[model samples]
Target chain A: MAVKYYFYPLWLRFWHWLNAVLCILLILTGLSMQYSNPDFPFMRFDLAVSIHNITGILLTASYLIFLVGNMITGNGRYYHLNLRTISTELMKQFKYYTLGLFRGEKPPFPINEKRKFNPLQKISYAVVMYVFIPLLIITGWALLFPEITIHDVFGVSGLHLTDLLHLIIGFFVSVFLIVHIYFSTIGATPLSHFKAMFNGWHKTHD
Target chain B: MMIKGMRIQALIWMFFFMIANAGLFAQQTDSIPENVKENQKCLKCHGNKYYSYYNDWVEGDVRERMNPFYVIDSAEYYNSNHKTFTCIDCHSYEYEEFPHPGYLRMEPSYSCMDCHGFGDEWAKFNFEEIQSEYEKSIHSQKHNETFSCWMCHNPHEYKISARTEENIKEVIAYDNAICLNCHADIDEFMFIAERENPNVLETHDWLPNQALHFKSVRCIECHAEQSDTLLVAHNILPKEKAVKKCVECHSDNSLLMASLYRYQAKEERNKAGFFNSALLGEYYVVGANRNYYLNLISIVLFGLVVLGIGVHIVLRIINK
Candidate 1:
């Protein structure tokens, strides 16, 4: 039997889709500015700077909204970890994805009304959301207002350090986006998760 | 008792001598022929190629008889615009005396503006604009010791760049050398600065490709005030106030457009294709020098990512 659950709420769904749009725009504009050239431009130099700045500001706002919504909503609870089961459950989920799924073995953790994310999803989401995103945002803000950055740290210039950090983190986040989108197809149907984000319902086999 | 009394008398004599000859040391005079003759007499000792600090022993009862400040390089003096006019043309007339009146040393020194600012005779040199910019410089901010143009520009050897080579690289080196003479030397910097001198290399380590930048541009490109009136801005800002943002130079509206490249021939700048296209003819600035190959590489890499995603989707469909 298959079941449909009202897993993603309206506000969470809205934030997720909005974030998707903002992230894509930011990625394009950021890459364009970073790779801009005089002889052959990825985009017009002026246009890249303007678009990157504007999109980055918008993404900052979206990030804040996401933070505030998580604070006031039940969706945040799914991100909370169970220390006892974390390691064991994470291993189980990893194996299920890597080999068990193709071998037609049952999933170690399945989505239900009581649980929104598997252990692997919870840990990865927590790291990307809580750690990488915050760092990126901080470095991004530091770049925007260079005066706020430290003048020097261990003989390294703070601005250069900040710029390098932003570039590396941006690259990782971009890669995560690619893999995240691909894995979105791993549900019961390839388009099932995409539909759930739009309609706030997740259909699962019971 | 007689020897003690003689020593006391000698001490009193020395005090009175110093008090009486206080105005004697001022260096210059106004008469043209007399100025040359007088200067030649003084230069016999002062203009010695090796005249560094003048403390040679003299056969006299005098203590500290030689004035270290009296030494000036004859080569540099002759190289200056004031060469034919003699030392006394700028210094006090009392300097003509073999043992100058010490009180004359207390007289104010003559800056270029003493004569140059007086009329339109040297207006073409833009001394007025330079003075105006200098007035607003961080160096001009009130301190224990007054800062002056002579600190950075040794008037004795400062050949006006505009009158010399327009090659610009040499001009940049000459101008930057003046700043480094003080900044790179802690002992020299201490004369003007109250705080401990910053380590130049450490302070500038944040500057990307520092050696390239140092060689290519004047220090004033980042440190000096940006002004519209002067060809080269003279108002040096404090370090904290200097341009720190990379975008200040890296962007399309590069500050170098008004500064470093300002001397570039119009035809050179007008040969532009895109932003900083003309700039590539001379040198490569990291952000400014956009290359076709790099842009293509980026496009190819991004296309590969999207293509990989499409391939995975196709594989998934086949499995389904």
Candidate 2:
């Protein structure tokens, strides 16, 4: 058996980990503020607010960096949404997860330099990266700006609709996490996919 | 003969004295002629003569009259419950002449303790103590100058129904005005704070105005109740409890609560580990009080991170 070489560049790995950690922190503090029960007083309300704002700014900056880096590195090609290929790829990935993977088969698609994500992953990541995350950042920043004014952001005066949109997008991210976990388990072994992410190599019977 | 003569003389003298006294008594009675007639003459101008004495004389015509002293209603004395009793019944003193009301005239006033004989018990009511404490309160200093014992506990209408929603709203509005009157600066400050921290959603434009903030929320909104079991009090709550209280209104599409929650959540999370899932989730369902769907997203994010790391580590060990 030889190991397949699907290199995740050092910058990509760095950004991925940083984004993951920061997003987790944001979500945790965010939830605390939302529920605000006595038991969850990880931070005082005022301090949590400052931290959430700072972290949000950091996340937005990092996301921009990632975007620019991808474009510069020519890795942005991986994000293209080709409908014909994506539709077929998504169907095949679904079948593998639902039936084939359970029957001790390999994944229908393989990770390579050109195609980093399976069809489902590509579509989901595109939505999260281009659509949802950007919307969240804009709304979150607009919320921060007293000058921008909530009315200016959404043609309204209060944060109700804005909060709802933020939460709804957050929900999508959570669903993505669950499916991501399940797929990780479907690797060559329960832990193999996780290992590949770190070492940038996967074992395959040639 | 001398003793007998002395006795007869004494008896004759006693008899004469008795007759003379009787005649004098009758003449005196006739001359007085029951001054009730004179009192009736005075009553002609005094409306509702019987209740006149009970009227709030301090605020009544007596205080308003240009003439400091005018007895327009003597009927109050004649037709009162003490009608058979003279003015001296309660006064216990008589006016010898006009303009000289008397050296020590009792004021027409009574307390519940006076008639009920609860003087001893009334002393233990500790009203003075409560009044002193209230006088020192921010509400007292900011609002009413004459914040007496009767201000909150109206002596005439001392009922707890003052806690009703309508009454409370009125009180809150009044109390808020007190703050505004003194601290106009707070309104602008809050406006800036709200604008700066609009939350992740960009829905609203400005924070609620000073009037809306005070009336809609109170000091207790952020400061928890003294008693843990009390859900709400004086419209304030402990910060944690306040957040929970907001759920009653903000959750489930409640615009106010939702906006407040988002702003708060972001703010709180920024400060410290106030809402770290690893810490708070074990105590209770993290999302039960939250937007459940959003919580799910958080969980998923967490799971993905875990999976990514787990797969990476395993593969590394195997390859090595």
Candidate 3:
């Protein structure tokens, strides 16, 4: 028996779980604060705002740390797109999800040290981590200090455009949340993918 | 001798009767009260016609409207901080006599230091230093020609509440009026005129190079109200709140509120066509019908909750 070794790094595990928890909290408090309703008793409006700001700062810091860690550990290379391989892998995964899996077919893409995520996940995470997250942070900072030199960084016209883009990106994140939960259920068993996230390893049944 | 004594007695009786009559006349003259006398004096100068006009106006009203120069809500003004003060309180000793000519009603000035007992502190503070800075402002230059401090701030009523939608519209209108007052071509300054004008590149010597589109935009539209003072400042929302505000406007559907349920199903599709159809349906067909979407969303959310719990249990078993 050839035992394949694929261990999740300690840093990756920490960042993943921290981001997950913070993102959830951010969404909950964000929803509560937005509506200004008394029903969501998790936190008061003022406290929720405080928590959201603090959490946002922490999330930004954590993302920076994650970026540095990824660069140092060479994990960033996994995100590099090879069009042919990606297209092929994505199609296989899609097919498995839609039709093949019902017939008790095995997952076409195997977990390896170099390629942990499916092609779709790779692309999604790449966009999320590299593009959307950074845009959101920059726009958020600009919005925070309207009296400051935000206009210098991006001109007045550009700032307004950036703000609109930021709002669209936020809508995208909400949609991502709904889709992420749905995809989390698509493993061999409904809980398999979730368990893997916690345990740092998936149990492959032969 | 008896005739002379009788004459002296009659003279004494006449003098006593005269003293009693004088007392009765003095009481009658002094009987008119101060208020009545003041009103009569005011009528003398203002004319009986003015008095009648005032009387007709205030007959059914509790407010006393003496001045017609400014539109004053007398009831609200009387209930304010200056309630105890009469018209003459600030304008004391202005009128030397009834119908005094060239008498100017003194403009009420505010001194926070007076009531606050910080007179010494204020005395040392140079108003000229701050006034010089304000004088340099663009707002100050335009304000000089068309309007004064009274245009924006009520001198008597210094404290103002948060800018309401109506007040914001009024402020914008005032800004437009200020622009038109200086600009010779009033049509050039008007929003619709600017849009229609073919000479967009033409530089008018009369008008400033800065665009007047800002005059059309309401103040509160861009500036958010500060949480503490309710005054519109700059962007004051924290990142989380900003994100939340963005979501509140942009989110197609929200599970957090009952109001958002109508769009919940459309939200899940991630299809532009579905959203467009949903929007059309919502506007044209659904109209006020929201219960259908609400019930559907509740069911879906309930299912999600149950699935999450079930997944949690399954994960626990797998770990074991």
Candidate 4:
């Protein structure tokens, strides 16, 4: 038997889709800038730059919305990292993905009202949202006002360093997106997790 | 990895080759070329101050004024930096008789580019682009008949001026002197323009503390091409196209960088074609240059993120 649970809330689903679209747009435009080859066109360089800057601003606003919504709705608990159980839970999740997943064993910890994410999802989401996203936004703003943000930190040039950091973080975000997509396919059915994200109900084995 | 290593090695070899060639070329400029040595006969007359006297009368409305001809001071000529060159070196016209037929008005004036082209040994110093730029200049287009290199540079006394760290003020004075020769005096400026226009000071009245700007910056810094390069392109822009934006020179990636902070590596002049924060430290250009420590932290954090992800992937696969 299977039971349907309201795992994803309305605002969370909206934020998820909005964040995904913005990330995809940013990555495409960012890649175009990084390579800077006219022959390999994602779009015209100037157009891409304008769109990228505008999307980055919108993404920052959306991120703030996510943060505020999480606080007000009490859904932030799902993302809170419990350091004691994290290691053990992470190992169990890792084993399930590699071996037990193929053996058709049940999920070690199922999603409910209190626990919205599996252990691995919780940690990855926290890092991506709390750490990487903020870094990207800060670096993006620095790049926008290069005259103000640039300085000599040690002997190295500050603007050069900012460019380098932006590139590195962009790479990580790109990799994370790939991993996230792949992990989304690991539910009961390949489309089940995606459907749950689109609506609010997720089916769990009993 | 192998390809990348080979590319690095190639760059290193190329760098060394450039350094070696630059040193060898620097030593060769000490001696004058053979062409200047062959024109002694023409030099004997023209090099003498007494030989420069002219009998032409000035047609003045008030009783025809007898303006005595000014002579080319041979003593000054000999002491000049270009003393190795003869009169015919620049004249380049036939003069077989005692009273040369084309002496007063030489048929063909030698263009400065005649010896400055790529084939010349001196062209290795990278002045070829300057010729190309000068041809496209508004000055060249508008005053082709009136404009000649001698107007600014005395061909007989031209010497290379060094622009070092300590002598920047000297360099600015020296460079601006060429522009000021005609520009500073109203009579000379009007004579060169060959028409009546508002004087330079009056034209630049829109700028605040315009005299200070004139003192600190070269005219060409704003009047020439707005390139990232430090090299002053010879394309003298028209007043309409001249840089009017105050922020263009004052902000980061300033136009002054190219005019003032020229490429340190003369050989790699093209390499440092764009703005670099490393090149901008002595003079702070706000917003263009950034802090290096924050950059390092960002890089390290990014690396850790990648490592963590890699480890997790490895662990997951290992459990299988």
Candidate 5:
């Protein structure tokens, strides 16, 4: 039998869509500015800079909303890992991805109404939200207010270090985005997970 | 067919009109003044030859005498920015007699300030402040060391505006050339160098890459007052007062930023004011410049990540 469960909440869905749009815009504009070939202009240099800065600010706000929503609605517990079983569960997920999934084995931990993500999803999402995204925000702010920051580090100025870190982490985010989109299609139906994200109900096999 | 015929007739009429106008414009520009043509004769002797003589001997000692020479190669003079101006515009005195008056040598009155010192255009630039500052500088304080503006700059051959990075660097290199001409010479620089420092390299040891610093940055940027404007400060400080702190030039709002940048757009300047990285387009500083290597690394990383995702997708499909 197939069952319908409320997997994505209204606030989470709104935050997810906003974050998704901003991330995609930021990545496109950021790449356009960095490469900077007039022959292959993605947009005018000034336009790219303006759009990138505005979208970055919006993304920061959306991130805060996500954090607050997670806490206030008690959705934050879904992300909490039992440290003792974390390695064992991580290995099980890893094995499922590498070998077991190829032989038609089921996921080690499945998503439910209470537990929103599989073990793999929980670890990756937590890291992206808590670690990578925060680093990007901190570095972006540092780049914006270079006059007040540490002026130089390791022969390069503080501005350069901030740019370098931002670029490095931005690469990781780009990779995460690609992987996230691909993984979103992994459900009973290709559109089932996407539908769940939009309407808050996911179809699960029992 | 009728519209095409009309277009051809219009094109022919326009071509003939352009030809007639071009001829008229050429005639207008070709009319040089009668006085300017007459002054070309003055270059016959003064422009083609070199003159040298020795003077100021101590007890008639030949080795200790000072040698002075004047040579203005016509080829070089014609190439100068001041080539269009007649000689009398600058040497503003009456000396038309066959034998020039001896009083001309007695007076040292020719000055750029006579024309460029005061006026709406000149006063707006504040060149008078620069002149006053120059007078108060360490170079002016020395009793025996008298230097003129011509010593460092050729009034004839100067670039007022360097629009490109290469041009800006070339202008800086030319200005530094005057200092290097004397400083690189053991006989001229030995006295100054010894009084300043025993070791030239050691004096500038605070700079991480002294060679690169000297190559790109003007000497006055460190040895003069940090100017808010693009012009170099004329009040040259003593060696003791020179800026040595690394942060002054390394920071986001660097002291050298104004003079170091050239031909920047208004937007670029404004962005730089807010401590933005948009101004990094023209030049590179150690920590302040962007690296293309990071972009290459990002591309490779993206490729690897995509490949990993592709494999994951293929396996999922096979399982399904």
Candidate 6:
């Protein structure tokens, strides 16, 4: 028998796709700005700057939605995984992926009403949503209005540090994006996880 | 009888004409600014270079230089910041006499602080702070009496271009001209300097993009002590004490801010936003004002991501 869980709500599904589109736009524009040649540019420098700023603002708004939605609904509890069992659970999941998955053994921790994500998914998603995104947002805003930033920090300029942090975090987010897409394919079927984000139902075989 | 009557009338008319002429001349002179209308009387002789000559001690040697006291470039004076001023406004009233007395030559010339030092009109220019800074400068420290405000700023020709010019490049060129006039020209340098005038180009050869640097910023930006309250610093540091470190102007907290870009920084409401919008504007400083560590990190991180993905795909295939 196959079980269908109403995991992704309409709002979450909408916000996810919106964030994905925005992230892609930001990445492209960001790369254009940092690496593009003045004469032969990937995108016109001025145009890329405008698009990046607009998309970043949109991402900020979308992030706020995720924050508020998590606060008001039960979705917040899923990210609050136990730190005590995390190491053991993470190792078990890591082993299962590397060994048991190829051997066609049963998943160590399958999705349930109580557990929306396995340990690996929970940890990575938690880090991306709670830590990396917030850092990127704060640094991005600091860069936009640098007057508010400290004049210097331990001899280095605050603006320089803020810009550097923003770039580093953006790079991490880009990496997470690639891996996120790759891991999404490793479900009951290749496209099952991607399909679940659209139709708001996660169908799994028991 | 007719000749006698005509002679008598002519004598009476001549007497009345002399009295009226004297009264009219007095009235006209009193109606005009006494010193203002007299510039032509002075410029007629002073404006012509060959009209006067003087021997002055320059660098301990007697040099027969043209008497600057009696000769001035009228065209330059007309174009100066004090173009509207009368000569007497800054000089003694005794100079109106011909063959000026030997004691009159000893009369002290007015400093910029004499008139600009007092009153609410000049309070906004921070002339007091400028004076204080100038007092501390190497010029003042070494040659207190010899180097007046006229040395760096010839009030006769200086137009306050740094404060008034619409184009910054023009301001830069005009400001540097003052320094180069003495530093670069051998004859001019000889007037003050005891040593040989070294080639300015060779002195600044260590600076990358020497021509661009000269055009981009005033000489004071590196050579002067920066003040938080002053628009342009007056404390001219000695060449040995001048900023030689590349990072002084190249780093994020560039000295250019305290010197060259101070006005723009003060005026900009949003500092980062202003730079962002003016990415291709005149404010853009390439190579100097840049942070590349993040860029390098971004490249390395991206490369690692690709490598990780490649290994992941290979591991999956092996398992399959």
Candidate with the greatest TM-score versus the true structure:
4
Error of 6 at A31 (Å): 1.8
lDDT of each: 0.72, 0.52, 0.50, 0.68, 0.67, 0.77
lDDT at B303, model 4: 76
Model 2 stretches astray by more than 4 angstroms: A1-3, A39-47, A146-157, A201-206, B1-177, B183-320
Which lDDT tens digits does candidate 6 get at residues B1-320?
Answer: 99999999999999999999999989988886644477877776677755442434343433233576557887898788888888877877677775566788688777899889989999878899999999999999987867888888888788886556656667788888999989998877777776789998999987654665686678898899999999888999999989875445543456777776666556543343323221112433422334355456667887887887787668767776
Task: Score residue A116 of candidate 1 by CA lDDT.
Answer: 87
lDDT of 4 at B163: 35
Worst 10 residues of 3 chain A by lDDT: A147-156
Listed per candidate, the RMSD to the true structure in angstroms reads 14.6, 22.0, 24.0, 18.0, 19.5, 18.0
Stretches of candidate 5 above 4 Å error?
B1-293
Q: What are the models' TM-scores? A: 0.51, 0.48, 0.43, 0.54, 0.50, 0.50
Ten-residue stretch with the least lDDT total in model 1 chain B: B23-32
Candidate 1's residue-wise lDDT over B162-257, tens digit each?
Answer: 345556668778888989998888878887785668888899986645766787678998999877756778889988899876555665666776
User: Residue A58 CA error for candidate 5 (Å)?
Assistant: 0.9
- How many residue pairs clash in model 2? 39
Docking class of 1: incorrect
Superposition TM-score, candidate 6 onto the true structure: 0.50
Better candidate by DockQ, 2 or 5: 5
Best by lDDT: 6
Chain B, candidate 1: TM-score: 0.67
Best by DockQ: 5
Q: Give the per-residue lDDT of model 3 (tens digit) for B218-243.
A: 22222222222112232323222322
CAPRI rating of model 5:
incorrect
Model 5 lDDT per residue over A1-206, tens place: 77798868899899999999999998998776665544445576556667888898898999999999988999889899787888898899889878976887777776667777778888889899999999998887765544555654664456666776887788788888988898788778778888988998989745
